[model samples]
Target: MLRLHRLFAVFLLLAAALAAPAHAGKPYQYYAVGDPTDVVLPQPKKTSLVLMGGGPDVDAAFAWLIQKGGGGNFVVIRSRGTDAYNPYIYAMGGARSVETLVIPSREAANDPFVIERIRNAEELFIAGGDQSDYINFWQGTPVQAAIQELAGRRIPIGGTSAGLALMGRFGFAALNGSITSEAALADPFDKRMTLERGFLLLPELGSVITDAHFDTRDRLGRLVAFIARIVNDGWAGMARGIGVDVETALLVEDGKGTRVGAGSVTFLQSVGLPQVCQPKQPLTYLNLQGQRMSGGGSFDLRNWAGYGGATLPFTVSAEAGVLLTR
Candidate 1:
């Protein structure tokens, strides 16, 4: 009788464990339909990065990413979502390889299986979600290190919206919360203007900061604020910013970037450190240059020069108040 009772207790526990949701007790939820072990080995190719603002991805841009993915073994990383992109990726026609992993916690982001998949992936895409979730969960984990390895191997990597937010050397990580232009211009040191760095250090994006949904969100003021912070904080000698509008993407390869989509991509270069940038004060900077690029336009990241578009020069100052002039 005693033996039977013990057996019954063990069976109940097993059943309870089996009934639990897959990936429960971990930091994230992971769902994959394809085999991660069956990925094709890495190949030497020009690594590319596609930075999409917030919107529906242009077909041409995704087509470009699909081609770069090589084979069907593409991987998508997100904080929360299903493998919905798999069908679309498979339709783009490679080896029919697509896998999606939603990592919700630091533990899940560092899971051996998750890290291994990321390392093996020929192409990786970061889905649009809360950038703060990304920073909080992925930073300082083996997952973050694995991404750096992928970049080192020259594999294709890209992201949309919040995912795109982290691709730059300096990121508006939104750790505290989203900042507004009014708050930022009012006080360049607003607590909401959280920034983070060192997630992925790609060469082409050195000294660069990125913003998404540029025009739609009217983020120019805030991006300027971010650039001000970078320079004032001694994060870089002078900071450069790229703001991509909705339905737009900047396809970057080598040291050059080409813009594509319906909206525009703006580049802002800080001539030098701000003359007057302090906590609780508006910014006063001279000769902050800017250029706007449309579809089929190109820009040299190394030189900050534009092709196929007018490289307009501009200045920003906050003597009495903030003023941007071309």
Candidate 2:
């Protein structure tokens, strides 16, 4: 009887241990190309910006803009989605004036026609898909060069979902989800996830980073995780996570600053977080300051001025990245 009781106690202890939540080993790290606050007003001759809602029929709206902007002969680059060859082609309807280029893979990303269409295009749009694919395939190829050239010429470049993610100077690759979800809420210090370098290099835009499906999907947690990774790796003293809710878009100008369009954009500013040592253990360091500011709300990017000012929610030891939506 005594032996049986001891065995039962051991089994109970094991069960309790198994019931506890498992902790990730470490957190992911994300890097930026430049500072977020630095806004460069483009030359008047070449300045155009566009934003697309995640779930809405924007064909008519885009068509109208293209026609008005003298972009009757436009080009659409569809790199994302399952049907890569004709990704998001329907979004334009039969807008006969515009031409479409569906790049199925990284190999096709550098096709001469693709490059020519992108370079000559007055407006460029990237379809929604896994952003990491954009980074992996087009980061340093001729297609990327053409996109940059279009930007230099002052043409509008827009994206949605993964497309939106690639717009920022720095972008999250979604390498692993373990640390991403947890770190967004609190400081989960185990830096387990790995980030891809130079994935979204928009140097002219500075070190701006962007994310999609903000409030609707409750992405606050993952945004915080991104900030933690940036701070932990000494990438930046402060980081900003721009969370875009579904069916919304934020319009950003070179010098005029950011403006809200269809939906709200949540800005997650991380000032501090609890320090942790190992996985599954409570954080020791506390006294962290995190704040959520929205576009056109009390927190205005233009009003914030440089990295340091009263307009900002918290004092950033280092400049945070910028985030855009659409």
Q: Which prediction has the highest TM-score against the true structure? A: 1
What lDDT score belongs to each candidate, Candidate 1 first? 0.80, 0.51
lDDT of 1 at 104: 85
Candidate 1 segments whose C-alpha is farther than 4 A from its true place: 1-27, 33-37, 310-321
When superposed on Cα atoms, how far off is each prediction in RMSD? 5.2, 18.1
- Write candidate 1's Cα lDDT for 36-102 as tens digits: 4565655746768888997887666777876776665688899986767777776766644677788
Query: Candidate 2, TM-score vs. the true structure?
Result: 0.63
> Which candidate has the top score in lDDT?
1
Locate the minimum summed-lDDT window of 10 residues in model 2. Answer: 24-33
For model 2, how big is the CA root-mean-square deviation?
18.1
TM-score per model over all chains: 0.88, 0.63
1-326 per-residue lDDT for model 2 (tens digits): 99999999999999977653222121111111112122223333635444443655344446433543454334556554332212243344432234445565666776665575566555566767666667667778887888877677666666777777667655676545334444433334444444544443442334445677666565655555555666666666655556666666655445333434455655555455425423444323323333333345333343334222212333222112111221
What lDDT is reached at residue 149 by model 1?
89
